[model samples]
Target: MCLNLPQMQSRLLLISPGQSYRLAPYLKAAERLGVSLTIVSDSRYSLTREVADGIQGDFTEPSALLDAIIAQAQTTPFSGVVASDDSTVELAARIATRLGLPTNSIASATLSHRKDLARRQLQAAGLPVPEHWQLDLAREIAPQLQGLPYPVVLKPVSLSASRGVIRANDPDEAAQACRTIARIIAPLSNPIERQTLLIECYLPGQEVALEGLLQQGVFTPLALFDKPDPLTGPYFEETYYITPSRLPDAIQQRIRQTVADACRIYGLHQGPVHAELRIDGNQVWILEIASRTIGGECSRSLDAVLARPLEEYVLAAAMGNPLPVERRSGASGVLMIPIPRAGVLRRINGVQEIRTLPHITDIRISMESGQVVETLPEASSYLGFIYSTADTPQAAEQALRNAHRALDITIDPLLNS
Candidate 1:
């Protein structure tokens, strides 16, 4: 969509966790568009406070946080609220609602983050959803697995980026996966989320992600990403996201329509939406939809398609500016460099060579040499991200793959610690 700059400098409240990679992009976008950005986070040590006015509150205690925000609003009122990560979307919605700003309903925001609730809502709306049921971690799980479908995916109700998401092929595997995921959730601070898991019949098909925006219940398609890697797995660690999808034009249109329908069902009437879906033959199953943009540095790929960083669109929309819908052209992609094992990073090689490869735009290694790294099913962070833009989806996909191949990464085993 084309940008419609706001008439005056609009003050925005951005609710983002301290660890989010999204803060910087939004900050830069706000500066370019002349928006006054205030960062509200749960961390006192947030670096964003150095530049932007920041408010730190205990996100777990929303009532207190809202009170603090309201107090600040009385002096320097905020025109809108935006959530920079999935973990903060519900809180953002609540804040927006309390301030009488445009936002999704609190129930809709909550449903978007909780898989179990979202599945039920979608099914009730007659959307194509997989067979699913919730399991209580506090109860005996073995008997509950009896007569259930084989090859099901067990995932935490609240976690995103595929953390604690595992696929099991049999009862034994399911039981074991349940126990492991339980342990993963145990350390989490949310007690309610720690006690629930969503188990669904695994749908087999190629996966694709749609990045779009919504305004007053109308959806605008921004970009559609093709996940070239086969996500069929015991653990789904996302890799390459290449767009302009190779799929037929008709199928892509259907995918966009399905997502728009989901937004209506979720009552998401404003801001950015990121959705993941699986296509099996003519059937399109909704896997996930978030009331936020695509996570991590993956959103950088959209810059080539949108002709501006996606954060600009997100920020402008939050300020109630109308965005012009632009047709996507050319091809761009990103590879979320995966952590190969659990250990401390020791060394990285071939970075210079990878930078020289054709179509490779940038490579960022987010982890330091002495920092610890982990693999998926337990890990949430990627080693870094590799970006590329090309003439076609095939070329873009190949560039990312080629860049990954050039990397020689080494990690010391965790047992040695």
Candidate 2:
């Protein structure tokens, strides 16, 4: 099964390559464009030999990862370097630059990542956001802060997926929250593992995401994802998304413009960007942006929903190729992993109903029997995903829900209240 490299097109370097379970759609899209992707493992890669170029290693140590990418580029002549995960985006930028490739500036890349850095940079750019206070793990405690805002959000600047996010509604909750925060920090496999925590005023509003590309500082805005839940709590786990964002057309324009501005403010030059925002009516606050594609099943959802392959666009954009202007892209939807309590999956029923439903592409389940599921700190547990498309967003929504409702999921309780 030796495939000739000479016939291959784009040689893509995927840093931090892990579960491509979410990368299937992108891989399919790349194939459509005749792009040959090579995954350069960023850490203990579990996928196997066929996953990528097999540059197996970690990206936390920038120099090591940079050297590896350079080595691969020498042979592969990579048209693009993609950091498939949030943690390794910095490494991706360095790799692209070392090869005289297109990517965000190193400083901007780091700032666009790491929530704390992003906040500072955005604030400097005069964007509105939640008020915050940086912490000192050793500090005894601030004495004059008794009158501050309650329901504060304790979040790590580096990690996504609400990894180290906690909420404190009051001083007592804040104290307990502090202990949980300590636990969150102690398990750092690396120094960069959630090292910084910011206790900030929790903004009450709807949370949403903007997924698109920033090329040479010009923004080619794409989809706006609406997470239709109060994602504000202990661990803000995202559960669902709908395209043609529920936000009004005008408001959506503002969000795109704001995101583009944020990218420029952060000095993003190229590559896909995923940004989170909190909006209450017309007033929108910037949450954070990552210099990479939207995580979770989003890339798949977007590809299936839009009828346009995002990975191809990502590859084209990454390589300084032009992508289409944002226009009447079709509709698609996805519901992210949600909390279903702590349990072991027993059986899933009603899947037959999902199959019969129209406008549905796929229903995916990530966990299996005998596997432990935790839903606390917000409904962060995702049982799986349901992808659908339609002539209109409404039709897509109906078909997916019809499929979802027909299914019966039974799980063995692991931790019952």
Specify the highest-TM-score model's number. 1
TM-score of each: 0.96, 0.88
RMSD of each: 3.5, 4.4
For model 2, what is the alpha-carbon lDDT of residue 297? 64
Q: Candidate 1 residues 1-417, lDDT tens each?
A: 112223334899999997689988898999998899989999988899788998898998899988888878777777789999888999999998887778888899998898888999899999999999888888999987877888999999999899999999998999999999998899778887999999999999999999999988989988989998899989999998999888889899999999999999988899999999999988899999999989747888888888678888888888889557665577999999999889999988988999999999999988899898888898978988999988999999999999999999999987752
For candidate 1, report its TM-score. 0.96
lDDT of 2 by residue, 195-247 (tens): 45677898888988898887777787778887766776866877667786867
For model 2, the run of ten residues with the poorest summed lDDT: 1-10
